[model samples]
Target: MKFPISWFIGLRYTRAKRKNHFISFIAIFSMLGIALGVMVLITVLSVMNGFERELRERILGTVPHVIVGERAQGVTDWKSLEQQVLQAPDVVAASPYIDSTAMFKSSYAGTEYGILQGILPEKETKVSVIEDYMISGSLNELVEGEYGVILGAAMARNLGLWRGDKVTVLVVEGSTVSPAGISPRYRRFTIQGIFETKSELDSRVAMIHIADAAKLLRKGDKVSALRIRVHDVLNAYMTSNYLRANLGEDFWVSDWNRSQGPLFRAIQMEKTMMFVLLTLIIAVAAFNIVSTMVMVVTDKQADIAILRTLGASPSTILKIFVVQGSINGVVGTIVGVISGVALATNLPAIVKFFEEKFGVSVVPGDVYFIGFLPSELNAVDVTVITAVALLMSVLATLYPAWRGSRTRPAEALKYE
Candidate 1:
């Protein structure tokens, strides 16, 4: 089988044994460096992708996409407002809720401050994932007059409270005015259910029936806010604007971006910084390619002279070297991509294994937004990484290949 002269020569040169052992070592090192760099970059970026995905599915899933409320006071006619908001485009579901800050005290534990939410059990499932995360009992048990409370898993553990245990809830805004001074309003609630999301929210949020919440907050038939879920969460900001315009100036519309935007933005910024920093690894590997090619050109000067004496052109010499370096880039990139994808795909299981073996949590449920590592492989990110590596590899070959082509047959022959 006949091959093109340039390609045939290039392939032979790539596999040819070099007299200098150091050059061989350098070639191997360059390939390994590129491979390692590509692998690490893919793995890290996948983990970052995982974090973003978890934020969307877990955090955003729990929080309302948008909240519409009266600017001056709670919404007294929330049912009418809910119907109105639901009629707006992109809005899928709406639920009325009462929110307040309260201190929970258990007989066995100290007081813990948390956000207390009042939700209609049947309607809550339409807006939040709380019902899906319930570990024990049921949200429906939170009867309107029962004064039952559903505590987050971590919160329950912290307060050492269990189902059927009674806890005291003190609301600062609902304090009573006395002859001497104002006293905090308090109520007793029976622990009816516990939910676990393995997030920070699990340690900071508690829920009860909206009717009970209104009574405790001293607000009759009124809700603090109307939580609305949209068809596309990413378009919540635009939907919020639409709601604001449609609902008029009497109400204020807020979206998840206002509440959780900073955290989301920080994650994105960090991902970008990491990509920039890690690209330097591939660049360094490319430099090694430059060094390896330079050394090869020096060792093959006599061969270049012989080829030139036999009528080989300088352009042919350039193609040979470029092909050799590109082969290295292509092989390293292929290997790295395969290995990196495998590692990233199973990162969560690997993390869980180590955590169980070591009996220590890398991501604690009470601290981070998620308790386990998450990984997502994006095609765009992988393509960008591979392209950047190949481009760098090709660029690194230019100076050395050009110098090799510029070799003078007469001068090279005289030295030989």
Candidate 2:
């Protein structure tokens, strides 16, 4: 196969021998650096993607898709409102709830404040996915027993309480008596079950029977909000808008965005920041491409001059360098892609293997939301990363190629 003399010479020069041994090592390191950077960036970004996916599945699946409530004091007929909203397109399940801030206490520890949501078991199962992640006991326990309560895994950890353990709550809403005002009401509850959502919900919220929570709140058979679950979460905002338009101005509706706004935004922003920061590694490594090509031009100055005297065009010289730099990009990118994909696709298993062998968690449950680091290789993300690296590689060639083109045929041969 015939090849351009410039390409043949360019490639040969790129492979450093004894005289240019240091250049060879620098070239190798540059390739490795690019590989490492691309690998880490892909791996970290994949993990972030995994976190986002888990949040959507485990947290959003169990939280309300949309919540409708009366904005002002007195409670309207939520049951009637629920019926109307249920008829909205894409709304799958709707349940009434009474939410209030309360202080919970137990024998082991005291002073745990959290949001207590009153849910009707039968109705709630249709709405939230918590029924799937119940670690212990049953949701039916709440319906059967008046004093039954369910706690999130993290909240349970904080209280040092477990299923069948007795817990007491001081309801803030019931602090006022009809004649005797500002008297706190206390109720004893048994821990019926524990749930593991592995998100912020696990640390901050607990559940009880709807009737019991309403009674405790002194709402007298009324609910402050109706939690609605839709067939599609991506369309949650649409559902909220539909409910708001139909329910009129007196009623207020909240989507998952409103309920978990800060958390979702923070996660997204952190992921973005991580990708940006990690890309710097790739950028730094790519700089080596520029340096390597520059050195190559210096070492081959005489050859370039000879080629210029032999009728080779400056554009051809430029193409030669560009091609050489691009080869570096291609080889580095391929190696990084393979290794990074392997690491990401198997992160869960990799962490598990290390934890079991070493007898210590790589990703401890206490620190992160998951006990292991999660990773997901997204095609779009990989494509974007590769594209950026390729672009950087192309850019790196321009200076060296231009320098090669400017070689004076006469001066370069003066030593001869």
| Clash totals, every prediction | 0, 0
Tens-digit lDDT track of model 1 for 1-416: 87768787878988998889998888888888889999999999999999899878888889989999998889989999988998999998999999889999999988889999999989889999888888898888999899999999889999999899998999977788889898888899999999987777788899999999988989898899999999999989999999888889899999999888898999999999999999899888899999999999988898888888998899988888888877788787888888889999998999999999999998887687678898999999999999998998889888888999999989998956
Root mean square deviation (Cα) for candidate 1? 2.6
Clashes of 1: 0
lDDT of 1 at 47: 96
What C-alpha lDDT, on a 0 to 100 scale, does residue 404 get in candidate 2?
85
Distance (Å) between predicted and true CA of 112, model 1?
2.5
Q: What C-alpha lDDT do the candidate models reach, one value each?
A: 0.90, 0.83
Q: Choose the strongest candidate by lDDT.
A: 1
Model 1 TM-score on a 0 to 1 scale: 0.91
Q: Could you tell me every candidate's TM-score relative to the true structure? A: 0.91, 0.88
lDDT of 2 by residue, 1-416 (tens): 89977677667655537367776677777778878888998899998898788778888888888988887863568778878987999999898888889888878976688899888999988898888889998777896347799998888988899999988888878677667667788898999999987777787788999888877888886787888989889789998998888888888888998777788889889988988888788788778888988888888788788888888999888877888776787778788888898899998898889889989877777777667777788999899888887777788789988988888888888886
